[model samples]
Target: MLEGHPWFQLEVLAASGKSAGNKYRDAANWILEEEMPEEVGNKQVEQIDSKIFENAGIKLIFSALPADVARSVEPELASSGLFVFSNASAFRMAEDVPLLIADINGDHLALVEQQQKSRPGYIVTNPNCSVIGLASGLKPLADNFGLKSVFVTTYQALSGAGYPGVPSMDIMGNIVPYIHDEEEKVEEECDKILGKFTGEAIEPLQLNVIASCARVGVRNGHLESVLVELETDATIDDIKNAFTEYKGNKDEALPTAPEQLIIVTEDESRPQPVFDSYNGSPERARGMAVTVGRLKLRGSKLRFFLLVHNTIRGASGCSIMNAELAKIRGYI
Candidate 1:
């Protein structure tokens, strides 16, 4: 997405280290060292600090640090009055910090006025990857039919595990049935992402999410099998409409926003990872659309298959867009 924004001049900021190690080295090499062939640009190779913030005169900070490291660094950055847009799980559930998905809950930015007590810097963290896909598919349905319960089985991508992730042998042809803390993160983050802040606190939806996660071999997209139960009595048409024309982030003019919120496929065998994973919304909507297939509505239950680009839409891309939205809204 950095490449997509040509109108603005962006400089390379030092990529901080996570508990695991350097996550930005490879990319910085390409963007800073290699991309600029002749001119030797200034590159800082130090840890994140208030010195860098003060020297750089940075107005905003976008952090994709490891969860634990973020637990420590994020509050510090925020204390310095730097607007923080994070993709870490650190402060996602904080009543004051926004658990943002630009398409679903952009209005929640109003609560930042009250977040001063948490830290000098207000933080906006995106929801978990699995939850992002679930929430995108649920938002329109909830607005239309009042979603009550969602049961999902996620075939999460290897990239979601991060750098030097699960060994190739462990996931080559095998599907590990359980991923520690994944189900809980999905369930909780989905509720918060779809929630609204009520002056005093963020009030998450009273929706139930039951998830079963497995480590899959797919390099990018995280595919899920979801079954949603609505509170109201509705027909299959209601469900189809939710996925057919749902366009949540379109009006925002977000550079990375998808044109359609949920993509409904009639091709029975559609939304396959190899083909459909890259479609639905590949650019601004990149990782922004939830591709829904096998729509089956029987009585109160609605079943479908969904896909998401775990890292792009679910991780870095989502964080980047959240920052962009904040910038456009004058928060940074």
Candidate 2:
């Protein structure tokens, strides 16, 4: 995605082990079917060293580092005067750091400026994968109707665990009821994303967010069954209008910003991962939108199923969108 961006280029690739100093195409092959395109495939993979940032004129670091590694490396990269757009969990809930969902809380990116006062540069992060869908679905409703409480159950995909994700014996035909740290992350991050950012820090949204996450057998999109009770009474049509009418950050023209934030559907069985996973627009922003379906309402309470492409709207693509918004707003 970095290489394909008009303003960005895949200047350098970094890795450890034998893959280092080799072509990116020849690096780790975790997904056998998705070959690295020759365009970026030919770039040489280098060791993860600070020297490369200056030597290659790299201004941004799009990190998909594991949380344990990010806990150490990300601060160093940010201190080296490089903007780090991380998908890792480290620093996400930092009182000073911004757990940003570009469209939802672009204002939180302002936290980077304050962070830069202490560190040489800044680290801005997208939220946990599951929180992405949950937050996106909740934003419009929270904004228009005001949230009383949110009860969400996630049917997460296999790829969310990363390549070679769940072992065949444990997840091939079964549904695992829990994912380590996922539920807690969802509850905490949801409050932050839906919260109001005070100038000094975020005032977490004061609402009950009950989340239950599970790993299912699907390959891509993360599916959510959401039951929300709004503070204000509304009809099902009002909720649908809130979703389909949501236009948070699209007007900014960020490269990865989807033309529509959410797509509301009427089909009862429509949001299954296979046919409804990739629902965004303008080609460049495909899979960046959330698909909401099976919406049911009872007075102030509403229920719906939402699907988000975990890798796109949730992780890497969200990281990229944050960078684009940062660049436009001069935060980078």
Candidate 3:
């Protein structure tokens, strides 16, 4: 998306030691040769090393490295005066780091100034892939009716496991009921993302959040079943309208901003990953929208299911949107 954007330019492509193999290198070469033939022009993946920070012209770094690797280098990259928008779990919950969801809480970017006081550059992160969808779905409800507690059970995609992912034999016809620290990340990150940014500090929401995560057989899109208790009574129509009416910085004209952040579906069979996985509007925003279905309201409680493209709105596209938000907010 950044490559296609008018304001942004594609810079260097760096790879970790594990991803510097012939296969990965060849793939990067192929993409440059085929898709970005004119612009990239014979570029090859450079090994990410100490000298990687030598590029003074590079102002931003987008990273999807493993947590430990990211933690090891992010500070150095930031200290080198390069803003980092990362997808790794490292530094996500740091009080000085902003866990950003562009439309939902762009105000969180305010924390960047505080971070810059300590380092020349700063880091911003998107939530866990699964958490992005759940948080996006919850934001509207929390804004309209206020949330008391949230319970989510996620059916995450295989690709979320990264390259090589889950062994086909283990996941071909099975559902693994555990996914590392996914549940805990979701539970904690949601509160911070949905919380208030009081200029000086982030006050996490006091709502209760419980999560159960599993790896499913699907190739893309994380699907979740959520049950939420509201702080106040509201009608079913009111709940539906909150979703339909919700728009997160859509009018800002950000390159990757989805026309509708949340798409509330009325069909009982809708929001399936196969069809709704790419949900969004205005072409550029495809795969950036969260689709919600099977909404059920009982008194002040609500039940629903949502889908988010695990790698797009949940991962890389999420980081791209954060960069755009930062640029618009003058942090980049």
Candidate 4:
């Protein structure tokens, strides 16, 4: 997004110590080849150490580090007055940290002020990849009809495990029914993301969420089968219109914000990875939209399937948009 934005600039690329000579190095090289300018192609990946905090030119740090590594460096970076937008699970549920989704909860950015009380720099996080899509798909419904409870079964993409993930022998023809703490992350993060941010603290929504996460062989999009119980009565048209007319972040003017934050389809077999994986508009926002299909309503219950680009909308793109929202909200 920085590459396409007019106000921001990409200045540095850093990596963890263990990434040396690994796929992380190769992936950085690939990004340089495809996105970086010729003059910046030779820029080396710096170590994620204390010295990086001393770089005055660096104001914001975007981290894709594992939870442990992020937990180690993020506090130090924040103490040194550098804003950190992380994709790790380290500080996501902290009282002051905002688990942001840019469009869905831009207002939650206010929580950073609480962090600023202790340090000049603060940490903000994007929700887990699976939670992002599910929360996004549920946001409009929660707003329009009021969600009572949600049950979801996720068919998450392999890319969510990161580069060189899921050995072929293990995942080639198999669907792993469990993914460590994925189910818990989805259930908890959703409530937080959909919560009300009081002036002093976040009030998590009381709605119950049950999730079952499975790692599928798919390469990109994460697809979920969701059943929602609404608090009020609504027709099928009401639910579909909630999605179609939903414009959570479309007006944000962020380079990475999608034209449609949520796309509702009438087709019976849609929101599929093959055709809808990269759904988004305005070139820069590709792979940033959540696609929802197979909408069905029975009494107060609503059912549908949703898809999200796990690595993009669920991770990096989420951080980028959060930063953009921060900038717009003057929290940067």
Candidate 4 C-alpha error for residue 128, in Å: 0.4
lDDT of 3 by residue, 84-113 (tens): 999999999999899999989888989989
- lDDT, residue 322, model 1: 81
Q: How accurate is candidate 4 locally (lDDT)?
A: 0.87
> Is 2 or 4 the stronger prediction by lDDT?
2
- Ten residues in a row with the worst lDDT in model 1? 31-40
The best candidate in terms of lDDT: 2
TM-score of 1: 0.88
Candidate 4 residue lDDT tens string, 200-250: 789999777999999999988999999999999899888888888888866
Per-residue lDDT, model 1, residue 280, is 42
RMSD in angstroms, candidate 2? 1.3
In model 3, the runs with Cα more than 4 Å from the true position are 18-41, 49-56
Q: Looking at candidate 4, what is the lDDT of residue 214?
A: 93
Give the Cα lDDT of each candidate. Answer: 0.76, 0.87, 0.87, 0.87
Over 231-303, each residue of candidate 2 has an lDDT whose tens digit, in order, gives 8888888888999889887658898888888998888788989988888887878889999999888888899
TM-score of each: 0.88, 0.97, 0.94, 0.94
